[model samples]
Target: MSPGLQLLLHDASGEWSSAQYTFDQIAGLLMRRTTSKAQDETVAVAGLLGVDVARLLNETGQDARMRAFLLQVETVPAAMVLANAPARLSFPGFRWAPRSFGGIEEEFVRSAGVATCTADGLITRRELTILSFPKVFVSNSETSSPDRIYLHLPESGSLYAMPDLRKLGGEGVHEIDAVIIFPSAPETPLVARQPVVVVSTVNAAPGQDAEEPLECVYRFRAYLGNWSDRFRPSQMYPEMFDRPPGEVFITAQRWSRRVMIT
Candidate 1:
């Protein structure tokens, strides 16, 4: 865990009394079951106290004194919501926003002979499997534009690696264990088959004058490997492409935009 989160957990453990008090303050924000009405008053009290009622109740491992304090805190209208309906007091559908590519335009292009390679099939299957796992955007940084992106892939499942073919390398012979295809443009194939190490350079869109400055563009490469693997495709080829978005980040944004329009 990061040092900041570790400190947070440590501080939470150290001040059991204060933490419990905070928890109770959160619980008080819930509505009373008997009245079947919202408890704006409790929420106001919690806000005035500058306590996060939701986080307090979610805290675990507090002492009996803390728990007792929670009971008193629950008397508040906001806290009543927890007393009446604990589940409702739980925060749901809360999530971090996906990082926007902004001026960057992503296009996938399939390489000419990637489909003919034997490893291509395995790579494609692995890509599909990785897509099934949850993804998270860890960080993004760049100058002309965000050139690097980090992602956390889930480790619940495993991925088998293809045999190394670098020793037998030849012109046009498969040098990478995996290949990623991109969406093709009008004259380009929908997929751009890229080796695990190949970095993509984002070129200006066709027909705009060279003198006209282009927006910041970043190209990223996605690699396939076991979740625990230390070498990420993006890290291996930083000079080439940026990084792929996490599966969850991509999915949430896609869903959110769809929902908003609908």
Candidate 2:
């Protein structure tokens, strides 16, 4: 295990009286009991409307991006890969507001009308937990890499790294193995660390669960990359789009592992 990962596990296993749960309890709480009501509705609509999930998504635009993307995918959080792409590029459907990653998180909390969520309530709002230099990778293959991308926060003048493959040999190169520390987290902020970058999110429709509570089957991780222009994808790569969402999500889950403890 990388020191960073070990540090995060140590932090996670620390004895904080607040926002803590046993691994089993965490599993129990996160486990799905019945099918999601939203999923049920989507399937029903797709059947009655005589359109497949993919078709419905293609026909629609930003207004329904989140739901539509989730419906069409054949996998889990991996669906967020495509769903997150638009946001990564600052696309309208996913951008928190008018081409930005900030404030979108607060939108979810307010829309949910939740002052606090979960038992301990540290999860004040739904925000994309940005992971830079991610470690403790788990996936089907030993060489698998989580799509740990990054974003630049012009407002704060921060340069975030998304475990950038483009910067494998850069100077002052930092690799965080076991732990992730978020210095600027809003709800439950961890001590901020340097080599920090910016924001990322699920970048889906806003105020989704405004009516009632929701079962958060998946949490999206967005990386507002802060790499120099040279060390970045010259253009969005088509190859990255072809892989299974589940596989990508498995990698992402591990990448986001440390941050999700809250």
Candidate 3:
């Protein structure tokens, strides 16, 4: 261990840790001092997490930020957890599905470093574009609101907490890294909404043509935030930007109006 660096040790829960590493033993895989077993339990707990943790710490090579994060992660939750869900499947035939569902337009806007939606903004009726479900059947309602649409990324169509490549390139829509649902409102909200849900994806980049996803979907993440009407902010929602070429999207119905996107 370098005299400058003190190894950090903590459990997965980010609870119960030790940081008493001496200057001499800091240069090892898992630092343990002959003078005490203070780091023993920490090592056992972290060891159960797998060798990956050790590798990450080693690869990070004493990066203070990552080390701090690992030691006090409970205080600062990971911006995103790569695999949290064990059920949902990923995009099997992404582009072959409805192009309207893919948020390529949003991606194009974001890659340019522009905000697609926001905590607040004036979105003209057409500015907040929507599409039809290609089918019509909602209770006994005779009139279907043009703003009304149906979006379904079946579990089979969604890549949940797993590492599998799913093709997201096809005609019409160029690239799609993720599928999200925004709970806004029936009409253009003059204000903000509460409890925004976001899902971000890390899929293979587009292949030769737009039809192939060069890589398989390896990871994705989810986030929940306070009220918001503007496009997903990369700052507030790092998960939204931690993805491939495609960007974040809102695929569900808006559920609020004029509250405040705090």
Candidate 4:
């Protein structure tokens, strides 16, 4: 028998009397259910095993035995899933406003060299406008609130974004690059690194035809930070400015919310 299963069986035998009733109930359910195959069978196995494991791990005077048993069970998928699944990233809270040009819209307009007439004064024209989408915010924990910034690339028909960093200055200023961390597995607990370039600051403008015209193009570079590590490449999306004709010209709105990361 495999070392892992041997350990499980040994532990089960040691706790047989206490765990028999629960294991019998779970085994009965599995035998009676014929409709579900893989899923139901897996659940039944986990249920039967989990009861014994929990009793041994939680009962008094079973510390050393339980610890050894748990060490062996750590390699099991069912045990790992039940143990650490709660800490994984789930339902990340943050909305992306690609169309409305949220928060960064004003910066995008200024970067695009679009002049806006205001009551106080007229804004000067800029060389390029770049906008990042899906501004992330801290939704759950107060202690750790990481922000993710997404950049929209019109020319490539894609969007590039990252968490934990943002551009420092406007167009024609200092060039910026970002390093992102990727995890291999939920249980591995190691972070892999990748580098992404912050392209130029050009923004797309509303065109005369149905599709929005390409206002300007920006250039950026992406390099994986750690050579030995592997990570999934960032995703890209088609040009979002494609709109039907006759759409009214509206000034882009700016996102005002600020995120602070220590």
Candidate 5:
């Protein structure tokens, strides 16, 4: 428990009656006062606010205090969506967010950070840049890696690890159509070979008016290769020799009105 919070609670009816704490302040408290473990930090927040840790852990729904602590902060709270993430929240708007950051492993890659929350604690929407693949084949065990996913440029056979794909969907590799989205723009200047991180994917094409929302799966790092660099199968993948690379363009598109984190 934090001394500031303890004082605030102790003086709730006195000088601190109308006192308020910013998200930064609370988040700072969590980092400084609690251990590095995410579960302990979560529980410490709940305990400070008099919330039942057991209930918060057991129930997937959001707790009022916890929601306020998470969303009311100055900056947007981020939820890591990679495999082996420490914790995951079942709250309606936070389905794509990690429940706790206590035991996060090194494999965690990307997070769903672009989102807005309603005043009433509902997550209204999440925004991300999406790239849909016309052709995608799952990598096999022999070729696949626990920390990386081998990928060729559209029609090109060369492979690179710009956006590292570590522990994407756990240890197993599976087949599915990729609807890749970048949660945030690259830190560097926008260029032909822009950096892109995979946020979510869908097995089938959900038309613009499809009733069902896209369920967010795994996230990894990859790149939008420059069209000029023609990838040749002779370089890496002989099977891809027949398919010549095409001109790939980077455009902004809205793929999720609402997103689900799995």
Candidate 6:
């Protein structure tokens, strides 16, 4: 054998310590390196996944491509999702998902919780059990609040939306769906009550119709505050803007049917 190959084999064997790193971790590292050098991400992903590159490239449907990529992801600790800034998913259906864990932003959520990728991973449907409110009036005021933010939502009935945030498109009150998420278990007292609230609004991408079947779906936004009679800034919870959309969703129910991808 050549000297270079011989040296490589020797060094590889010497570094085969499971305590330091498992085979999967090493393989993942190599895959990232290879992907960085490769011109096409799809080709690189397919090669590492042992799938037919030609078939994957030629696949016309976006859903097929998304399914092929998600099927090969490692499911142990719930395949890595929600990459930090500068690293984001660029694929068709996965644009909302992150690419890798970049430094400190990796603490967005505990786990992705076995994502159920469907409709080519573009339209992921996860069951969430949260405190759902029919409507909320979001407004930015210069009043006495800590953050100068005010909000009002009913407990049993729906109310008119007070759209004061300029980013929401219009100036009038529009009805929108809102829900509160508990990052920790229900037993935690510091944040035992609702700390993180998210609202689901219409997909407001410019030049794109709201009813189109194409990419760019609904936006899930996180806010830090509390509500007894009104909304006020909370000191208990951390900043939740960096949390992944998939991680924010939590459910105790299990799927009745199993999907085995072979």
TM-scores of the candidates in the order shown? 0.15, 0.22, 0.17, 0.18, 0.48, 0.39
* Least accurate 10 contiguous residues by lDDT in model 5: 244-253
lDDT of 2 by residue, 200-262 (tens): 222222345433322221212323333344333332233432333322311122122211111
Error (Å) of candidate 5 at residue 7 is: 6.4
Which candidate leads the pack in lDDT? 5
The clash numbers for all candidates, in the given order, read: 28, 16, 24, 12, 8, 3
Instruction: Name the 10 consecutive residues with the lowest summed lDDT in model 2.
Output: 106-115
TM-score of 4: 0.18
Better of 3 and 5 by TM-score: 5
- Candidate order (TM-score): 5, 6, 2, 4, 3, 1
lDDT tens digits, residue span 1-262, model 3: 2223334568789775645532112213232223233222223333332223443344322232233223322211111111122222222411111111111111111111111111121111112211111222122122321111213223212111211112211112122233222324444322221111122223312222333212222222233232232333332333442434322222332211111000
Tell me how far the alpha carbon of residue 194 in candidate 1 is from the true structure, in angstroms, after superposition: 8.9
TM-score of 3: 0.17
lDDT of 6 by residue, 1-262 (tens): 1112211123555653213333234334533242342224444434443445665566544444444545455232222232222333445444434333222133333322344444344331222223333333433322311221223333322112122233321223333343324234435412313233233434322234423322222222334333332323231122522323211211111111111111
lDDT of 4 by residue, 1-262 (tens): 1113322233634653323333223333433234332222222243335424443434333223323232323222111111111111111110000111111111111111223222211122321122333322222232333233333433543333344322221122322222111123434322233333232222322222313222211122232222111212232222333323321111111121111000
Better of 2 and 6 by lDDT: 6
lDDT of 5 at 138: 35
Better of 1 and 4 by TM-score: 4
What's the lDDT for residue 29 in model 4?
Answer: 44
- CA lDDT, every prediction? 0.23, 0.29, 0.24, 0.25, 0.40, 0.32
The local lDDT score (0 to 100) that residue 210 gets in candidate 6 is: 26
lDDT of 3: 0.24
In candidate 4, which residue ranges exceed 4 Å CA deviation?
1-122, 132-146, 152-262
